[model samples]
Target chain A: MRIAVVGAGPAGVYSAQELVDAGLSVDVFDKVPAPYGLVRYGVAPDHPKTKRIALALGRTLGNPAVRFFGNVAYGLDLDLRDLLACYHAVVFAVGADDDRLLDVAGEHLWGVGSAAQLVSWYNAHPHADDSFAHTVLAAREVAVVGAGNVALDVARMLVGGPHRLAASDVPERVLDLLARSRVTDVRVIARRGPAQAKFTVPELTELGKLDDVDVVVDPADLAGADDEADSRRARANVELLRGWAERPTGRAARRVHLSFRLRPVAVVGETAVAGLRLDRLGVPSTVPAQAVVRAIGYRGAPLPGVPFDEETGTVRNLGGRVVDATGTVLPRLYVAGWIKRGPSGVIGTNKADAAETVRALLADADGFPAPLKVGPATVPALLRGRGVRFVTWPGWLRLDAYEVALGRSGGRPRVSVDDLATMLAVTRAGDL
Target chain B: MTFVVTSRCVGTKETSCMSVCPVDCIHDIGEQVVIDPVECVDCGACVDVCPVDAIVHEGEADDPSVVADAYRRFGLEAP
Candidate 1:
């Protein structure tokens, strides 16, 4: 049996590996020339340890039964109809890339940005513009809107000492910006009380231990706000907050204020962000901030010829089977990961998610009509006919080696190749 | 009894392990954190607090070399 997976990210690759283990040849396609979607793009560069999970994902892609087709966009190059015609089944694992907007006044101002954009800027995503680095360096104070892990990551990156970021996979442009940054205050604002915060315990505690940054928590925010959950994680977050609240103010050069029960009413500025107006207990208060980043969440874009639920920003699916607007299953079509369940969970979470979908696909295998005579070679031939230049697994390895070589002299890990043209060039380089 | 810090702790110096280490065996190297196996009491406090699941028992690391590397990183004998 042959299966095609759209996306080379954790979700798509993990599902492909599961299918390959079940005695099927799997083809994984990605828009970029490299694999490991978010692991390469979404993760904060300072947290290289978290990105290490990519090594395990890399091993899965190395399976002999699996083939990678990079630089091949699904909708632009081949639509859903074309996929159904060639393979017995197609699994869509394209993750949510767009950031959820704040929708408040002055949101489109010059200094306003998204946490995802900052993450991309640091990680050197090909799509992230180079100008963002200049904007980041110019800011004196930043306001991060949200209470989740992404918000904490943004806060940490803003106040992260130069020493913490200098050794990671951060690109040269971002490193230059970090060197010139004037940022002194970073406020992480949450709409709800401390107990309702979405940040994980480890991420929150790590903030307190920043060598040169002071973690300040308002004691009043903790009053009457009891942790609503029974889990150890909930208690951990509260305990961490209380610990930060008790930390005596120090002479730290930078400060990260973990403020809660404050909702952004408006981004107050005419042409660029100068401050923010927030509503706390129905009282309006203005806080000075040069930059505003919304870490609210991510929303998925609908794939061509696929049913999508606008409310959830997810492809319509049930037990990994894609369903149409009429609630009928779209035969031979399936989805997993953020596009299937909305943006949530860490990288390892995708393993079980992919496994669940693979089981459903196997259960319905008999119903899928015999795949067309077109085999593994057929797809590549078709792509070649269309004048598309795709990167194979070996091609990706060449680019990986190039990145590592680039960072070797600096005593850092691989320095990411940010531009698409350079990435394609490196992937095509001979003698890997 | 011994404890080891794997590659997962390289960039993420999640110090929950250090806070829980009963014998103060966990040491922060510049690039990564390490545990002194000789000083370690094997209290299992570090294992429960590692956010990345990077800590493991002496014999339980997915890569045996990672444990030795951790010891070498801290200039200690592999337990």
Candidate 2:
């Protein structure tokens, strides 16, 4: 069977691997010129180990039974009807791309931003805005509004010291801009208490290990917090926080202040972010921060034809099967990863999640009529007809080599090309 | 003795170790995955499966600091 998987990240690529193992021909499509959606973009550049997963994912795309169609957006390039007509089954593994808005005052201010944007900027996502570097450098004191891993990542990047990131895959321009940043004080704010924080223990602990940076936690925030009913992970987080609360504040130039039980009400500023107004202990409290970065969570983008849940920010589904508003299953339509489950869990979580979706699709395969056998030339013809300049797997390999070569000259791992024009040029050059 | 997931597993939470664990000792703790010593059978199934080669025998860890960090992260006592 010929199957089409949307979003060539961990979900889509892993799903393709599973299907290829099951003897199905798979075509993975992504809007970006490269693969590994969050791994290459959302994941912090310092985490080279996590980025290595891209190598495994790249190998999967290299499989003869699997093909990659990069720089081709599903809805924009080829609508749902076009995909349905071309393949027997389609799985939407498109992850949550946008950040959840705080829906408060002054969110649109010049200095206020989202962790997703910052992650994109540092990781060199092709579509990231240039203003991200300017915003990051302009703020001396920044307030990161959230408690998840993403929040910790932003906090760490702000204070991780440029020398520490010099060895990573961070682009040369980003490195230069960050080296000039005046940011010193980073406040990671969470609405919940210590026991209810979303940050894992390892991430929280890493904040304390940063060079010339002090992790400051309030002793009162850890007082009387009952972790009795919490999971082992939650209990461990509280333990880590308690340790941070007791540590003496040293003479570090930078500080990562972890604040809990504080609800951010608004990003208060006249022109740019001058401060963050938060509700601390049921009272009005204003934290002096030049920038506000909301890292609450990520929201999934709605597909053109797929049924989406605005309330939950997920594609309506039952065990990977896409269901309409009234709970009607749309045959041959499925979803996996962040879009199906509402953007939680780590990258490994996508493996089992995609497996489940593919399982359901395999089970339902016998019920439908045998799909018409179409050659590989059909989809490429359609893309070419629509003037969609798509990148093949070999093209991606060439672009990857170009990026690595760029970084190699600088003694870094890789220097990401973060613009479509440059990426297209690089990929096209690979076709030579 | 139990296996430990070092700094290499921080961002790459590959569960090849978890799937191979007979006792199901590997636990996802958000930032990284850890193997529970009490539950681990010392099968060494994870060492080979680690894509980044993050898994190592507790005694053979190249970096003592990374091993200690793993133990502290999982709330486990060092060997």
Candidate 3:
């Protein structure tokens, strides 16, 4: 069977690998120029080991039965109907792309940004610009709202020195800016108590290992959280946090202040973010912060012709079968990853998610339409005729070589191409 | 015009009587903001943000006993 997997993240990549292993022809497409969507651009550049997954994904794409088509967006270049007509089956694994916002006053003001935007900017996502980091680096104090692993990742990135960040694949421009950063105080504030924080134990432990960064937690913030599981985990994390808080402050470094039971009411200041007005629990007290970044969560976008739940921010699916607006199952269409389930769970979680969807596809394989054979060259020309900028396998290889060359100059494994034009130009040159 | 908050809603706290109010009479107590069921506009913003997911909207005769009990805890009179 000829299968089309939309998205080149872990979910899409793994699904394609599985299909190819089962002796099926697979074509994978992604909106980004590079594959490994979140791994390449959302994960902190310092976590080089975690990035090994991308290399594994690269190997999968190398399989003869598998083809990589980068810079292709559904609903734009190729709509759902067209995909359904071309391939025997279509699997959508497009992950959530937008960050959840706090519907409060002054949230859209200058200097206040989302954690995803900041992460994208540093990781060099094509859409991200230097404006976010420039605004954040200029501030002395910053507040990161949320208590999840991503929140901790953001907090650590802000306080981590350039030396620790040097060995990783952080973009050269971002590293230069961070090396000169004046940011000193980074407060990770959560509306819930410490025991209810969403950070895993290992992530919390990693924060304690930062030499230059101090972890601060108010004793009272742990109150009223005795019974909840999240609270219990938070208490354990706080024990480690307390140990780090007691350590002597290192010279010329930033500090991470873990604040709990604080709900941000408004972003303060006239022109830029001066401070955040927050409401503290169990007391009529409020704390002020200089910069604020909301990291509540991520939300999925609505793919044209797919049923989406606006409230939950997920594509509506029933048992891995893509559902229509009327809640009817659409044959030969499936979904996996964050789009299938709402934006939650870790990277490895997508493995199980993809496996389940693959099972459903195999069970219903006979019902799918027969695959249409269009010559490889004809496919690209057809897409081009539709005004689609489809990056061929050769183009991706060129971009890969360019990133590796760029990384060598910076003493890293790979440097990210942060714009579509640069990626297209390098690919067209056939420099790979 | 009572508004009930269920567990499925994200970020809800357990304080229920804060906004059953019809006349905008609820007052803030620390982080657990309470509503005055008497002057309430019957809007459910308070029930929505509750982290514990404990707000239940009820009609006038659904259960006055439970409503009265909640009102007493918040130091408010039931309508």
Assess each model's interface with DockQ, reporting 2 decimals per model: 0.06, 0.07, 0.01
Per-residue lDDT of A1-432 in model 2, one digit per residue for the tens? Answer: 899999998888878888998899999999999988987888777777557668768888999998889999888998898888888999999999878998998898888888888888898888888696588677899999998989999888888877988779888888888888899899999998888887765567678789999889999988767544266557767888778788888689999999988988888888988998989777999999888888999999889999999999999999999999999999999998999998887676688788899999999988755556477888888888888889998889889999999889998877888879889888882231
lDDT of 1 by residue, A183-264 (tens): 8899999998888887876578778888889998899888866546455566768888888888797689999998988989
Residue-level lDDT tens digits of model 3 in A266-382: 887887787887786545444455568889999998889888889888888886788876888888889988999988766656776887888889889988767565444544665
- Which ten-residue region of model 1 chain A has the weakest summed lDDT? A224-233
Q: By DockQ, who's the top model here?
A: 2
Reference-based TM-score of each model: 0.85, 0.86, 0.79
- Model 2 chain A: lowest-lDDT 10 consecutive positions: A224-233
Using lDDT as the measure, the top candidate is 2
TM-score, ranked from best to worst: 2, 1, 3
In terms of lDDT, model 2 sits at 0.83
The TM-score of candidate 2 is 0.86
Candidate 2 regions off by >4 Å?
A226-229, A370-373, A429-432, B1-79
> What lDDT is obtained when candidate 1 is compared to the true structure?
0.82
After best superposition, candidate 1 residue A360: deviation in angstroms? Answer: 0.9
